[model samples]
Every structure is written in structure tokens, then in C-alpha cells.
Target: MRKTAPKKRRWSSGGLAAKQFSAKMANNEKCETKPEQSEKNEVLEELNSQKRKFDKIAEKLQSIEETVSKIAKLNDDEEKSMMKFKEQIESLEKSNLLNDRSNEKLVTRKSFVVKYVFENLEKYKFDISKEEEHFSMNWHMEMQKNNGYLGIYLFAEPIPPFNDDWSIEAKLEFKMIGKNNSSVIKTGEGIFEGLDGNGFDDFLKWEEMREDYLIDNKLTVEVNVEILKRTGFGKNNIREFDESQKEVSDVILVVQDTKFYVQKMYLALQSSYFKALFFGKFNESEKSEIELKDIEADDFQNFLELIHGESSVDDDTVTGILNLADMYDSPTAIRRCEEFLLKKSKKSTVQKLQLALRCNLEHLKNKCLSKITTISDIKSIMAANLPEMDLSTSQALLQKSLGFWDE
Candidate 1:
């Protein structure tokens, strides 16, 4: 027992207690500490703020895409408008360069028909037609029997205070319509200045005309004229649109040296060209005075007058007004011109057909085609403008003309 005690004399109970306490303190030091609730809340708030910023950036990108699409559409529209304007300019330049008669004065034309009932084929008193104004001058037809023949004449009954040196180069045609729509046609060309008339003294032998053309002793005579040239009879104005109209007008339309004061809305209502000019994005839209090119002042006056419900439509002014209407794309003015040409106009059939074809007047074209009942009518229309006549029109006239071959 004494030997075992000396060999194992290494540890005491106090030392064992001290070592266990040290080990426990080291384990407590190695344990991790938890984070504060305030730090966790701050991290969550930061993540939320970053997500909101990313959402805002995405919205901005979508808005930018829409803006780019609108800009692209606008660019395409602008390019198309530029191309159309370029084509129009090229067409005008070509016309000016190639056509010497681009600015040539328009010819004045008229026609009148009369019926004379004769008791016998003998010399009778002069029968005349009511005077009609043409080329700003009065003209009439006179007929009489002389030397067993029916004589017809054309007279220029100009209004007084006339030009002392005025002269008109006229192409005249006279016809005597008979039963079955047959006639004797005579043509003449001359100059008329100061007279009421001049024509054939012996148009045809009265005996032969009575046998072939007279119906119940009635003679239907027609006269047509073309005023090719004139001098000293310059342009005249029917309505004055100067400063006198400034009180009620919104703008000034300047043509050459003439000024026309007018309201923009009134013109825009009747014309597409004026609508674009006054309201569209144009350089001249904001200007107080706009100059109209390639148009006559007198024609503008007539156009305005017709729009204002005045009787400004006549052969002397009809063609010019129509040209202006077509150029300006004015429907009211075009309809007015068409009505005048259709109803009370004294224009020749060939002349009317030519205008209908050029201006695309459907009603007038149909009316003219319906009245073409003779081979002579076909020949005249063909000779006037065969290039412009369409296939359907050519066919219709040809079919009608076949009926008159034996006549």
C-alpha cells in the first residue's frame, strides 16, 4: 500500500476542478454571436431600393422605344411628300422647256343656230340672231335670200368706245341642217374690225337647197366661229379685289400685278390646294401676301366671282376659269364651269368634246357623245383630237356613224 501511493502521486481534486473550468471558458469563447435586428432590416431595405431603381430603368427604355417609332413614321411621311413635290416640279419644268405655247393666249369660240320659215324660196327680209358676247365682243349671224340663193353672214357688233385698231382673225363655218340630220357646210376665214357682218352672197342655189335641205319650207342654219388672234382688245376686269376688300378679307392673293383680298376659310372650303396652302406646313402659309404663279389676274377675278354666285361663266372666260379650277382643285368652281358649258354655252360640238376630254367632264362627254348622230360629227371629233379620244368613245361614235353612211 505504501509503494502504490508514492508511484501514483500526480493529481489532486483542486487541480482537476481548475482544468475543467478552463476548458469550459474556451468553449464559451469559440461560440458565434447572432446579428442585430436593426442590421437585418437595413439590408432588406437596401435590396428593395435597388429593385425599384431597376424597374424605373426598364420603364424609361420602353418609352424611348415608342418615341423612336413615332419619329420613324414622321420621317417616312416627309420623304413621300418631298417625292411628290419633286415630280410636280419636274413636270412643270418640262412643259416650260418643250412647249412654246405654254403661255399662248386661249382661243375664243362660239356657235349659234337659227330657224327660218320661208313662205316661198324667194328673196326675204334679213333674219338675224340675238347678239351673244364672245371674246369680250358682241357677235351675231345674219341670213337673207338674194339672187335665188340663201346667203349667210357673220357680224362682229362690238360695243361702242371700242379700240380703234382692234382686229380679230376669225375662222367661220356655216351649216344648213335638213331632215335626217343632213347639212351643207361652208367655211370662211377673215378679219372683222368695225362691222356688224360679212359673209357669202351666194351660199347655195336656193332651188337645190329647197329640194334637199328644206323641211316644210323651214331652214335650220348654224354658224360657228373661232377667234384665233386679236390685237388692242386687252384683258378686262369684272370684279375689283383690291384694297377695297381689305376690311373683310383675311389675306391678299397676288397674281402678277393684281391683288385679290380674300378670306382663307372661304377658299379652303372649296379648294384642296388652298387648304394645304393656308393650313398645312408650308413656308408661305404664314405669309400675309401669297403670290400665285402661272395664272392670270383676270381668271382669278372670274373664279372669285363664280364662287360668290355671280354669272362669271361664259365662253370668253370659261376655259381660263376651268384651267384655274383644275389647277387649284376647286370643286365648286369646277361644277359651275361644267354647268355653264353643259347648258347655255354657244360652243361648237368639237370644241366642247375637246374640253370634256381634257378636263374629264363626264357629264359633258356623255351629252356630246349622245348628240353625235352623223358621219360629219364623227369626222370632226376625230380630226379635232384623235389622240385624246378613248377606245369606248371611239367605238360609240363609230357605231353611230355607220348609220349615216348611206346619207
Candidate 2:
């Protein structure tokens, strides 16, 4: 019975179908699971690659951060250096400015010393009569106290006028004589133009100049003047006259044994005294010869030369001519004298003040008073020539010193 049953082993339909379906499901599950695993492996590999890329980017970012930090520190250091450089430049500029101010002050002081020394010396004259030109030279010495330097001021005056639109070129040679007379201590040369006054000043060390130059506390100077060139206007326009032609005298006047044969009209035009004598009601109107008194012959000659524009009036002779001009009532000559005295008053303050008071010259009096700035200056004036001052003049000076007026 068991053998027959085995041979004909029968199964239920539902049960067999169920078993097949289970096996098929199991195989399908295996296949689906294999593809899914493969896909997950691929996804995992991609994720790993992305993670490595991110790490590399992080490293690059770290390197960039370090470079930026270095740049920031360098910029800070540069800014600090710039601040220090600016401070140094400012300090240097301040130092330069101070030096400039100091130099300017030094220049001003030097100029003041030069001017003061030049104006306070007595001048010496050189006789240039042999030149036959209307040229005169005067010189003075200035001794610098601080530097022991000697300054020689050479002044040339009465430069003769040239033709119209013409100028005269003058060349001068100056020499300093040694104690032995024949030796030359120093020499200089200069050239100038025009017919006005011209001058030159030179400074030399006192130690260097005193050894062979000083003799009896005196220094001798010689100058040679030459007309280097005459420019403008033709030569034919220059008038040449003989002695007889130049002597076109219409009147003769005598002063202290000196005779001046001059044109009456010119004299009348220049002097009120001459005008009253020749043109006004005076006994000498018809006289051919006139005699004058209280005038020096040389001073009168200088006055004549001044009116004729042939000479220059200097401080040495200005006061005498001023008196003569006042006597003759010649306003032009009086004004010229006043101007000359005003220039010389810087060195002769007390004398000028007395003269101003005596002559009642208001402008000159004011100038002299203005120069007296301190008590020491007033004391100096009093010590020099206080006895010469009149009562009214002394009172005025006292009032000025007491602050009664502003100079």
C-alpha cells in the first residue's frame, strides 16, 4: 500500500500553486535586492567624492585667510611708518623757517651798521683840477666796531651834463697809498653813467689794512676820473666856444677883492639883491661896477658855480652859502642849502638843532627833534653844545623831552 501511494503521489492544486507563487516571489525579491544594492553602492561612491572636494575647498579657504591676515598687518605697519615720516618733514620745515628768519635779522643788522657808520665820518677831498672836467671827489672812512673792518666811501659829484638824450660814461680808478708814499696798499676801479652823483664803498679788514697803510692816523687816497664814452646825439651838436666867446660878460661885481664878470640879467634872475640893485629903485642901477660886502670870495665863487649848474653844494660850504642866499633873498639857493643841511644833520644833530633855532628853520628843527629819541641822546646834545642854545630853543627841547609833542 505505501509503494502504490508513492507512485501515485498526488498534490492539491491550491497548495501547489501557493508553493510556486512563493518560489517566484522569492526569486524576484532576490533580483530586485541585487539592483538596489548596486545603485546604493554607486550613490555611496558619489557622496565620498563630494566630501573629498569639500575638504579641498576648505583647505584653499584656510590658505586665503592666512594671506589676508598678512596683508592687513603689512598695511598697519606702512601706515605707522608714514606717520613717522610726516612728523620728520614737519620738524625739518620748522628748522628751515627759523634759519631764514635768523638770516633776515642778520642782514638787517648789517645794513643798519653800514648806514650808521657811513653817515658819521668827516670827508676828505681830492684835488682833481688837472682833469679839466667839472668833477669833484670826496671820501670818508668808517670803522666797524664789531668786525674790525674799515669801509671807504668814495663820492663823485658834479657829473657834467651831456647833449640832449646823451649820457656820459665815467671810469674811476681808486688807490690807497702806503706809509712809504710810493707803495700801493690797495686799488679798485669802477664805471658809471649819467650826469648825476655816483659813488662806491669798499670794506677791508682793519688788521690787514693798517700794517702798511696808516701814517700819522691818516690815509691818503688818489682817484683818476676818465670819460670812457659819450653816447647819444651827434658830436656836431656840441657847442665849442673860445675864451672870448665864453666871456660874454655884461656886468662886473667885486666881493672882498674878488671880481666876477657876469651877465646882469642872469644875476638879476638868480638873486633878489641883484634884481633890486639893477632893476628896482637903487642907486647902483646905472652903475657898471658893483661892490658887495660880508661875503667870502671862495664862497661867492661856489655860489656862482651852484647857480650855473657847474658844481654841487656840500655840507662843508652849505651853511656859508645858506647865509649868503638868505641875505640875497634867493629862495632857490636857500632851499638847496636846507636840503643839504638836512642830509648832514644825521651826523651833526646838536649843531643842526642850534642852527635851525637860530635860523628859524621849522622843517630842519623838526627833523633834528625827531632824532632825539632817548634821554641819552638829549644828554649827548647838552654835553656837546647846550650853551649855544637860546632860551626859547632850550625850552622847546625840554618840552619835547617831557612828552609835550609827538615827533
Candidate 3:
């Protein structure tokens, strides 16, 4: 019974001692674990903050990559747009058209008259209008009539065929209104067919005869009435007259609205074959008979100096003569002037000399004789400043005039 009571006490003591030991160990472990857990929590918190910053930086990188791609695409688009604009601007610049009146063609038929008969119309004459254009020269002279037309040409002539030596015959083929169809045509066949050579002189003689006949007949008679009657144009072909029964001084042309008073005078002179009349140096006929056509150009110029002596002159004709004289020295022209130029004005005589010299007319030197003043005047003329006078002459008169008689 005593042992049993003590057992309960022993049990209680043991249980209480165990419980206290357990409580003490548990407290020590709690103290050590609490500091370690706090350090781990702080490390984990810092890791979380670092992870959030990394996530933000990664998002920013992705946005920058996308923006870079957009910028690259924009750059490509700008380049392409600039290229397209340059191409469009180049296509708009190269298509433009001239405006002037003188460049136009001559339109009227009535504008074909002149001082000389046109070599083309051998049978038909030209018709002219009243108003004269500054650039146009068209007028008509009365001639023989053929068919219903009063003209110098029977038909237009063709240019010479391959074998024909006469090339001037081709000019007649100019365009004109046709007789039959009333349309433009080139039916250029002359009514007269004759070989041209020495035979051509006969044609010229025929033309001269025809011209003489017309002039003589018209000068002596009221020929317009007969001409109108012959043309078969009744009252429509009437001629105009003055109150005094005198024919109007103006020429009546085919163009109905116009008339003009253009008169031409031709003067001819006689040449001597012997008996030097002016200064006894040379005969006029001998100068004329030198056959300038046969002489070479230089020889002819020397001959001009011998005949004309020395002269002062101006004009294209004189220039041409001086050139020819410098080159050929035709004695015929030169000597002719020396014999002829006396009692003539320096102006008119010099003018004639200039013209004859230029035209290469050995015969015309005689026409300037009245212009010489003195031997000094001749020397002055020789010394006068002229570009073309720079040639040596064989004529004694010219040599003396130039102070080179010894040379």
C-alpha cells in the first residue's frame, strides 16, 4: 500500500521534468529560426523587386523593336515616294508651232509685170495690178495676141532634155492656170520648136522685130481699138482716153483696177573703126573691134586701161571693172575711156566709167570721156584710194598717171 502511493508521485515528477526540458529546447530553436526566416524574407522581397524591373525593361525593349520596324518601313516609303515624284515632273516639257507673212507664197497672177520681158513667156505677156507691193514686181507690156490671150508666150516651154545644150529653156514650166480644165497644170510646151545655138540669135531677132512692129504701130495710130476688136472682147475691152483726144500717158494693164506711167528710154551711140577723134590716141572703132568677148579676162582689163587712161569712179560696175582690169588689164576698155572722157562732169563721167568698168563693157569706156579735168586729175584718179586699184597696168597713160612711168 505504501509503494503504490509513491508511484503516482514519481510519475508526476518525471512528466513535469520532461515537459520543462521540451519547452526549453523549443524556445532555443524558435529564437535561431526566427532571424534566419527574417533574412530569407528580405532576400525574397528584393528578388521580387528585381524581377519586376526586369519585366518592365523587357516590355520597353519589345516596344522599341516594334518602333524600329515602323521607322524602317516609313523610310522605305519616303524613298519610293520621292522616286515617283521625279518621274512625273520629267514628262511635261517638248511640243510647240511659226507665224510670219513674208514667208507665204506669191498668190496673184496680176503681179508678174516688169521692165524687161520675162524670158520664160515668149508668146504671152504678163498682167499687173494697180497696187505695187514693196516686195513684188509684176507688170505687163503690150504685145501680139494669140488665141484669146494677148501675151508673149504661146505656151510654156520645158527645160532642155538631156541632149539639149540650151538649159535656159526650162524656166517656162512654172505653174499656172490651165486653158482647158481651169485647174492648175504644167502643160509647158512651146508652140514654136527651134534648135537653140547660133539659131537662137534668129529668135532674138524675131523678138526684136515683133517689138519694133508693136512700138512703131502704137506710136503712130490709135491701135487700142484694133487690139480690142481683134481680141473679140467687145465693149469690155474699151480703152481709156483723155478729154483732148490724146491717149493717157499711163500704161493700161490687164488687172482691171490699176494703171501706171512707167516709161523706158534706150540710147545707142556710134563707134569709130579709125580716126581717133578726141585726143588722136586711138580710134573708137578700133577699141570696139578688139573683140572683148574673145579675150581672156586679164588681157581685156589691160586693154581697158590703154583705152580709158585713168578715171575716178564709184559703183559696183566700177568695182567689177577694176577687179577685171586688175586681173586682166583689158586695153579696149581702158583706152576707150582715155579717148572719150573730156568736157564731162567729174561726177557723171566717173559714174559712167564705174558702170562700164563693172559691166566689163569695153565699149562703154568711151561714154565717160567728158569727165577728165587735167593730167593732174588723171594722176589723182590713179592715186585715189581704191581697194581694187592695186594692179600693175601696161598702158603708158596709166603708168604715167600713177608716177610709175619709168617702171
lDDT of each: 0.62, 0.47, 0.27
Report the CA-based lDDT of candidate 3 relative to the real structure: 0.27
lDDT of residue 346 for candidate 2? 34
Task: Report the C-alpha lDDT of model 2 over 132-171, residue by residue, as the tens digit.
Answer: 1122222222222223544433222232233445544544
lDDT of 2 at 211: 71
- Stretches off by above 4 angstroms in model 2 are 1-247, 344-347, 383-392, 404-407
Q: lDDT order of candidates, best first?
A: 1, 2, 3
lDDT against true structure, model 2: 0.47
Ranking by TM-score: 1, 2, 3
Q: Write the per-residue lDDT of candidate 1 for residues 1-407, one digit (tens) a residue.
A: 00001112222111111000010000112234324445334333333444465567679989999986865676777868867888999777544431222243221222333333343433343465656555567666555665676666656655543578877766666666655545677666666765424466667677767776677666666666666555555345556678998999999999767789999999989887778778866676799999876566666788888887778888777887887777677788989899999998888777678777766799999999888775556655653433346545655664565455435
TM-score of each: 0.47, 0.37, 0.16
Candidate 2 backbone collisions, by pair: none
Q: Return the top candidate by TM-score.
A: 1
Q: Model 2, residue 98: what's the lDDT?
A: 28
Q: Candidate 2 at 68: error in angstroms?
A: 99
- Preferred candidate (TM-score higher): 1 or 2: 1
- Indicate the worst ten consecutive residues by lDDT in candidate 3: 221-230
